[model samples]
Target: MSLGGKVWITWTRKTKSNYVGKIILAAALTALCILMLKQSPSFNSRSPFSNHEPGVTHVLVTGGAGYIGSHAALRLLKDSHRVTVVDNLSRGNMGAVKVLQELFPEPGRLQFIYADLGNAKAVNKIFAENAFDAVMHFAAVAYVGESTLDPLKYYHNITSNTLVVLEAMAAHGVKTLIYSSTCATYGEPEKMPITEETPQLPINPYGKAKKMAEDIILDFHKNSNMAIMILRLFHPHVSFFHYFSLSVKTQMARLGEAPRPELREHGRISGACFDAARGIIPGLKVRGVDYKTPDGTCIRDYIDVTDLVDAHVKALEKAMPGKVGIYNVGTGRDQSRSLLRHVRRLTGVNIKVDFLPRRPGDYAEVFSDPSKILLELNWTAQYTDLQKSLGIAWRWQKLHRNGYGTSVTIADS
Candidate 1:
């Protein structure tokens, strides 16, 4: 063979060898990515509709028809996020869901699914069907008295169901979670303003169940990339406001707190006071008048529903993978005798009062020191005035004399 021909053959062979090496490297890289994606929890959980508008988040709100959950759903919708609310209507109200549906009539804006979290099959199915970016676990049997009476119900609803939810999230790859815990987990603390560091020696089954749920989430978070936030909320006062946009109090009343009559006994102090003022009941029965407090009544930190929802949204925004955040959400002020005084002055009704023995699991005083939330999430209670907040709620109550019933009458009080 000629010298030049041999050189050309050598160059052609080298070129072919280099091309084959490049193709092999590409194939290996692709296979490695496939394996990583299969093992990655975050990648598996990412929503299929991730190409939606910028800054838009798809959130699944469990128990979104309930008081705090409804308010949180509203806030999320107002901020232009897609929301899916799942509730069995056991303790939640359908009327609240109807109101939200009416407000956000646009499709893909709000969705309500009637499913009990206890049904693990149904919960897993729901997670499989929807591409959820985050989950707000707010569906739980929250009444302390009711929890004591039926501890199984609390365990099944709060603790066991929470395990179901975490399992589904792990299976589906949903990573972000905002848990609605209660300060009841604190029980009767030895200090006045309870901090996040306060020992969780729960006095009631409700609190104990919630603490168990917290433990489950914390355990799951350790070995996962899930961003978990546990907000230990205090007593929520019924009031209305649009944190993102300014709405009139009356307009705000369209979405005010309206617990069902059967559940009202387990509801907030403001709701019971409003009921008495509206003549639904003969009088307001004050439970526990022999506590260590100044007024011999159980004192609790009352957070406005708006502020509580704000903290949840902030926590969602601040959630980081592999990080767990726990905060006591409250106004840091105690409401005891003053809450009743405010209710009377706002309703213009001299509500009859009956002093009864302290309800079981009653605490002398339980308020929160929300400095951690303020510093970390930059959240603070804007509706600090007790009377103003009560007055806004009272107007709504006066309008809906039957608590979300169609029989609306202007109270004569």
Candidate 2:
């Protein structure tokens, strides 16, 4: 997605040649976008050790096998909290689930259930079997384009199922809920950065469903007295891999005065990875430059997967007696879209650009205003640089190309 642009079409602007009107409209839009940024919610996390509560707490994280789910589960476990995971295994893999299990705090403290959230009986049964102090909901249908085409499925799975889960929560008296909201709800923001107070103008079914779920959850928060933290999750990112890579690349860039870009060996862009004895070779893409950003490429908010989950863990604890806190999760930074160009510039990988039109349902640019969370929760994004983050992602991608982290195997399927 393109990040920045000098020109924009405004609803207030008239097509006719009216220079004064155009200037006024431009100023209005610029002011509105700035307001969105200034009003954005903050996101930061305290160390797990300091954040833990008085007594032992048992937490239930639904959809604990998926990407963000797994990451959150690990964070909860890292803090020595008891955790129970429930996943239907539709889009979740057993391998990812198993890997996450190993990261648990203690033995028998972390458990997994293979069940759907829609089935209140099943959810109730799990709660009855184990005492849970809080519940983190991450299970839902997620896909902007897919949701648009087949809205019913999105509605049924995300909206209907979430309602059922809420009912179950009410029945079981589970008041603490941490919802995994999405940035899609912001939908082609009239402004650059989006805040919690920004009007939810979703243009797709998935965003609508997520927004509906948030509304329902907040309603419950009002009546049921649930302590909820609605986290508006941004792009996907892995912490360990990306942070490490950035350190290496940044060091190299400053060490040598190439004035241009250099090429790095082990850090070469993996155009595609093959799990051979040699190692992983990432597929390199040269396109994505001509965007509106500085390099004419896409810019994204790729929070380290670790930081993403850390925020969730902190968010769950931050909820209070009567109010619910909504926060955005992202680096609040931009990343270049041209993987090859970035690799070449940062790591020095030579690759060709292959231009392609933006995909349907693609957002031009999306980032977070995590200032609120920082002010409220005393949290800040640990991994601040993008190049370091990309290096981490590439490393994780390489190691896991053989289904290292999650179980996603493709053999001409």
Highest-scoring model, TM-score = 1
Per-residue lDDT for 241 in model 2? Answer: 22
Which 10 residues in a row give candidate 1 its minimum summed lDDT?
244-253
**RMSD for each model, in Å, please?**
12.0, 28.4
Put down candidate 2 lDDT per residue, 243-346, tens digits, no spaces.
Answer: 22234332221110000011111111222211111232233333345556675655677666667777888887787756788998877876535333444554
Candidate 1, overall lDDT? 0.85
Error of 2 at 303 (Å): 1.3
lDDT of each: 0.85, 0.64
Task: Give the alpha carbon lDDT tens digit for every residue of 1-413 in model 1.
Answer: 99999999999999999999999999999999999999999777644343344666989999998888998999999888999999999878898898888888996788889999999999999988887899999999888878878889999999999999999999999989999999989888787789999999999999999999999999878889899999999988888764423334234337677776677777777888888887877888888889987878887888888898999999999999999999999999876568988988888889999999988877789889999999999999988888877877776765666556653544234
Candidate 2 TM-score, true structure as reference: 0.70
Runs with alpha carbons beyond 4 Å of true place in candidate 1: 1-54, 242-253, 407-413
TM-score for each predicted model, relative to the true structure: 0.84, 0.70
